[model samples]
Target: MREKLQLIMKHLRQGSLQKMWKQTIWIYQYGRRYWKSMILYTLLGVMGSCVSLASSLISKDLVDIITGHQTGRLLSTFAAMIGFAIANLLVSQASGYASTFISLKVDSEIKNDIFAKMLVTDWESLTEYHTGDLVTRWSSDASNISSGILNWVPNLIIYTFRFISALAVVLYYDPTFALFALLGIPFSALMSRPLLRRMRNNNQKSAAMNAKMYGFNQEAFSNIQTIKAFDLIHFYTDRLKTLQKDYISMRLEFQRMSILTSVLMSIVGFIVSYSCYGWGIYRVWSNAISYGTMTMFLSLSGTLTSSVNSLTSLIPSAISLTISAGRLMDIVEMPQEDYSQDHAVKLFEKQHKTSGIGLTMKDLSYTYHSGTEVFAHASMEAYPHEIIALVGPSGEGKTTMLRLILSLLRAQSGEFQICAGSDHNQKLNMSPSTRKLFSYVPQGNTMFSGTIAENMRNVKPDATDEEIIEALKLSCAWDFVEKLPNGIQSVVKERGGGFSEGQAQRLSISRALLRKSPILLLDEATSALDVATERKVLKNIMQDTYPRTCIVTTHRPTVLNICTRVYAIRDKRCEVLNEVEIEKMVKEF
Candidate 1:
């Protein structure tokens, strides 16, 4: 007896019921916003369940009337049965519609919030999550949570009410049979106890595996060109097959566990049901109850048993929901970047009347989470009306420096100040509101599938054709663009298909130029261009009437010739170079 008690207590705490309830309450609060619909749907469902139970009870009266134990008017009895059936049908339909509508609404709102949060979260922090995992959490896990709110929760409530009503009715006729109904309760609870933890583990594992599969497929398809070039179709196919096999294995294991649990529950159900049958037979044989009461007892016994089984099944559903909720909260609870600070904007406006914005980094230090130092107390300055070049060997924190300037990453200890026209300087930071101060064109193809004009206007939606043409001219792209069939209206495929690398590079620059940000960051933006074209583009950018601060990262000696000053990043230090130093570096290159 002592061992049995200990085992039962262990099972009760296996699935972290406290955490499950917390997740349930969190979802409940989201659903509570549409409380009117939820309440109405639940009430309708309960009413529908009650009406069906009434119809079942009326069968006992019909049997009694037919047996002549109770005299009844046949027409009135049949009409009453038909009325309850119609009422049940109507209530069930209304409940279905209400639940369906509410489920969709909740799913939409939750997805929108998650996507918005993803965009506003800190970049360095957000990069920790895999894209596929984020997508799976928002799509599949979120949908399951919606279904739980709409289906599992309501069914549990309806079944609980039915169980109580049927049990009461059975007791009303035969207390002995009610005791049999009570026997099923403990068996149902026991079946659910060992299943909650297993189900939750299976659910979380399945979700992760699915995300892995998604990420694999996404990467494979996105790099199809490289795969074909390398003649690795068979290699990719075998890898995908391996992922699919693993996914199937997990699913089959979960299904097998489900089957085993169901079989055990069914055994408990059969025992309780047969015991009630035998007891009712003995009662009838002893002339203790009439045929009508015996029939009612048998019917109520099955109903009570089924309701108990249904309620127990909810435990697994709740476990699934809690697992999904935990996955979603992992993202929704991340720290969001604060974007509404007005100090940057206030200073920008105050200094704009005097001069252009300049960037100043003072005693900056940075290290990665893995303890790899990228920069150490590095300081630099870039002013408007001049070009600043960051020259370094690959992977020496040049790109990291640009990202830090863009507010994509933060330094451990440093003051990155933004110097406006006046001498008044303020710390530079990245926020939604302050991001507009700088335009960044990173290395690689950044074009989407759209018309050239549409791509250009993405940053300034209301830009006129005249403004677009001017920006393109400034990037030295207008010459090629005007020669195209539709010029600015020419459609470009994904990643600027049908255009050479140099053309695409120029078009990307044009889009950045359209933004007219006071500060422009070009990270190897002109790598594909020849020396002459790159020189022209760089000259136009610096000599433009806007007098903006331009920061360029490059390995080309010709590109560095036009810069006002150059900073070389080497040996964890950033140092300014004079003409002789630049000449020496150019000769080394």
Candidate 2:
């Protein structure tokens, strides 16, 4: 039974070690560009350790010089010590700078890779993680991985060499002295294994709690106005206190385990120090070793103890790095959006260069992963120079249809295509790349924090003042924009904080218009505007010189007057209605 238990334990230990090694190798790959500096940094660290040991050895020579009555050589011997000191200083400074440079470089590379991956990952898959969790991984976990690659690995290597060199010096004078000094080595390492495991589990939980707290705070602050109006301040405050209490409890538990491991190591360290001292004194009294040599043994033994402690500390650090690496790899390994096979983007770009295209859907079907069927056997078509209105009661997939049209959500089964103008008359299936052919203005104020001109230039970076004005005029936004003190250059707050909902909507529409894509999608973009203003904006859009195929999701009846075709969506189906039918539906509302 004992042998069987030992065999099982051996396999478990090997499995854990193999897993940690793989994670370390993966993190190292991210620092490949800085590997050259990292190697030099480790070499410098080894040299610094060598200098420290040399100083301890030279102290023996100084003792010998004084006791043997060799006073004449004291000046030259002290000069040698000074030389080692200067060399150590230089090596330490160089290693410090190299480590900093490597850490910063690896941090930047990791962040850039994660950011690029997030941009190209499938939209629905990316939404599985909250914004706060993603940000925390990007900022905190990435830094930990960087430190693992550039700092922890190199320090481990340097400290191992230091321990070996110090042990050799002590053993040269008296082998038993080295054994006494290393009595606590195995104990320290063994004590840390369970502590390391516990620390890693606690760290993962703490990280999750922190992300939840961040998400809660972000949601609360973003809806502060709603909370104030509803008189829910105490409710939010109490919720915050609860979250903080949980966080504090988690942290305290981790610290308690760490302190227990520290106490065990400290006890072993005290025993080792006293045993080495007794062994060294006995060797000197028995005339087996000289006084100078005995002094060197004690000094080098202390050095070995310190090096062992440093080495053992790395076990916990390595565990932390493994957790961080695993968190970051979760995002990096997710399925990315396939851009190489996007034939629709190529076709749309070719067709839209000269003229616009109409959208068509045939026998479309879409069901959520939770088995909620959003659309089934749905079909619709709209031509350029035409305005199509998607009218439906709330929760009837009006916005879902607009999202499907924009390729933000893909259908489970269907033929959704875009057919070009008369010249080429090519047909292509919708994909991620096809999104480039459409300019979308989603619900609410989507304006970023920037100057009005800056926001307009986002879709068209080189749009001149004249071009910006033209797009704004097309959206009926120039009226208010021109009245501002700085006109288009006026600074806008985040989410259009200083602007009314109606004004922000017009700005968002103008930014989309500047793109001049073949297709335009307005998903409740005009819900905040009055009837007269909304009507004027739609009129301006339809009369613009460049032709466009417009699809709007709206519950407002006023927009129906200008729509060339109106479709009502209900019960997972879309039905086209004539003007009379639309009038009857409007009256029923």
Candidate 3:
């Protein structure tokens, strides 16, 4: 008791109570949305409990009629007993079905809402969490909240009503019997205080471990190719065994505590139950109450004990719900992506359609959260109908630069903007809403499991076969796609399986081309293509009538000859290279 008090005081000092209160309010908000359904469920449960109470009373009467051999009223009482039993069965099944359906609906809707929010969350903020961790919260934690909202609250109310109703019947028939049934309540309450504190801590550890295990499994499957290449299959299997042992150890520790508490509660319950049974027998021996009345008293006393047990069981469930809410709260409450500039971005696109858009960066500086500076005072430009190149060795922030331009990462201090014309006077600052103005193909096989045509239509969902073919041809992907047995309709397996890496890269480029944004960013997107084909793809972009501004990051100097301008990234800065400088760097390469 002292330890539990100390724990609570510590939490009060740390403001955990305030946090718990906020979580409760968050849960209530979800409950408020489905208040009508919850109210209906509660009514159904109360109706079921009432029917059960009536059945008990009818059974008492039938017992008395049979003992007395009273033929006059026996038939009617037995028939009434049978009808209540059937009614109880029907009500139980209907309510159970309704509860399941309602809970599932709640789960689906909550998942959809959380899934959308996570998609729009700030990319930089989301990078702090692993993919597996996010998924566990999205799936398991969200489910716990949904089930608790529909199940826990209704069960609490129904069980409380059952307890009170049962106690009332026992009191009406014989007040002394109620006292014997009440003997277990004090001991159960005393055991709960410490159990609750321990349960909360255990749940936190258990939830975190669940996330780690889930993340480990997801990553292993996703990187199976790498694992096989390195011949680390046995290593991975051994690691999985270690994690399973840890998980099982944690579950068993909690289970032992639960078992201990259950045994103690059971002891008290048994004592109270037997006392009630003995008192009823004593009354029957003394002829103070009839056998039927004694039987009724015994039944209601058992109901009282079971009902109390059910009500107390909800405490652990409530803790689980709060824990789940806190997990979800960490995710959904982070800074969301700001789309306030969307309307203005669309207007800019409409005005610049004919001339296309260009990019201008001046006096730009950026550093990562880890205090590693990517670049400082960087400056660059890409005019319409031009191909600009950023060349650098590894770890010089080529991909980081693309992320900055795409607004996936924020620069500490800089000017990155898009302009309607090459002169760069007319400009709008870059933001999440500006992402629609550019199409990007990062370094990877970005194809999902779908048809070749479906992959192309990801950027333009309503694209026709002719438009799809045109984009593929522009990216130089038409050669292989046209040769496929199903042509544009051929299926691509997961991670672009059944296709070479270069082919997947070409298809990704094709999807970007289909979007037809004014500006295109290709980060190492063409590294897989042969030099001749790579040069040909860039030429196709330049010859297109859209006046598109193309920016590419590459290590190859072969394509730099066709570029409008080249910028070398090194020494914590971006330096524009002249013809002499470009040639000198090509010789160095």
Candidate 4:
């Protein structure tokens, strides 16, 4: 079982190697933008390593010179060593500055790219990931990548060079001393295997706990009002505590393993140094090696042992960094939907004579993931210049049909088409740009913390003041908007905190209207409004606006009364009411 565990740990460590190379290449690509700075930094690092090696060699020479009473040579060597030390310090500082600058630049670039990708991803796919998870990946995971660039890259290079150079110098003085120092390599390798396994397991648990904690916080903040209304704060708080406990336990276990590894590696270092010292002294006493040579060999052996130990200590962190890089690469390498085809065309055409595109569904069907069918072989059509009302008992697929028409969800089997013009010659599948042909106001009047004008600009970025005012008038919102202290420029809190539900609904309508899309879809748009406000808004939308295709999904009598045609959805089928029947139904409602 232990061997199997060791094998699993080895595989896990190796798994991240490919990702590390990829991340290294990405950092190199980023460094290309500041090649001059990168070159200077690399040169300085090399110089620093050389200075360190020179210092060690100089120490040995000074000891030998003192033993022989050569004061002049000893003083000259001490002065040269001091000057090299200063140069090393200056170069190391400059390299740090350069590394930090490069890291910041690369972090910004990666973050921006990730955010842009999130924006353009398919809505369904994007919704599968929690908002906080994405945020953590973009921020924390990218930070790991940046650290690999700034610290790991340069340090790995310098340490590897120093280790090899130190080993070479020791071996030149006495090959036996160098071999003794090298014995630590296998001991380090043995200790690292189990420690790395423990670390990997702990890291996985810690990451899972973090994701859970972040998810809990995100949901809690987004629905604080509901949590308070329902008095569920303690429930969420307890859950958060559980996650925190798990994270802490995992971190403690990881630290314990690290400490154990460090202690074992230190023991190995001491053994190697003692063995080398004992053998060197015996050789000196036997006159097999001079005292001065023995001293130089001892100094070089100590430096080599330290370098080997440092390299061994870095292995665990390097493994962790590689694992983080693999996670980041998973996101960066996700296969995006192909949107680069010549055949791909916008869903709407300006030359279409129809005021709005007409939708037709022929034998449409859909099912949720749990194998529950929402609709099966249902069909319906809505034309331009009319308002279609969809009414049904709750849980009978009213919203599902609307989503199918909007292309937010695809039909499992059947044909749905948007005939672009009155002649019905132009038909196209929905694309990203085509989604712009319709304006949608969902069940909630969601708003951001921004000025009213800024919210309007979300629908139409370049909308003129006159156009915005006209849209507000059409939505019966201009009166309240004008009453605001700053009119269109008035600041609104998140979700329109200062406005009543009815007022927020009207603001959402005004924003949608500003888009001037041919098709308008209102899914329970006025459900938050009083009877009087609902009547006024419905009247303006149906009577005052120019002929356009409008679909409203609601059970409200006010909406049913104003719609030009009413359709009842029952048993996954749509049935249009006769004119007299519709009028009678409207009158009764």
Cα lDDT listed for each candidate: 0.82, 0.83, 0.90, 0.72
With a 3 Å backbone cut-off (N, CA, C), the pairs that clash in candidate 2 are: none
Better of 2 and 3 by lDDT: 3
**Compared with the true structure, what per-residue lDDT tens digits does model 2 show for residues 204-224?**
897799789988988899889
396-466: candidate 1 lDDT, tens digit per residue:
98899998888787788977767764464544554446666888999988888999999999998999999
lDDT of 4 at 92: 79
Clashes of 2: 0
- Among the numbered candidates, top lDDT falls to 3
Please identify model 2 stretches exceeding 4 Å from their true place. Answer: 1-34, 69-72, 285-295, 341-347, 423-425
For model 3, residues 112-218, the per-residue Cα lDDT tens digits are: 98899998888888889999999999999999998888878788889999999999888888888889988888887787778778888998999999999999999
RMSD of each candidate relative to the true structure: 3.2, 2.7, 1.9, 4.5
Please report, as a residue range, the 10-residue window in candidate 4 with the lowest summed lDDT.
338-347
Number of backbone collisions per candidate: 0, 0, 0, 0
TM-score top scorer: 3
Ranking by TM-score: 3, 2, 1, 4
Candidate 4 similarity to native, TM-score: 0.83
Worst 10 residues of 1 by lDDT: 421-430
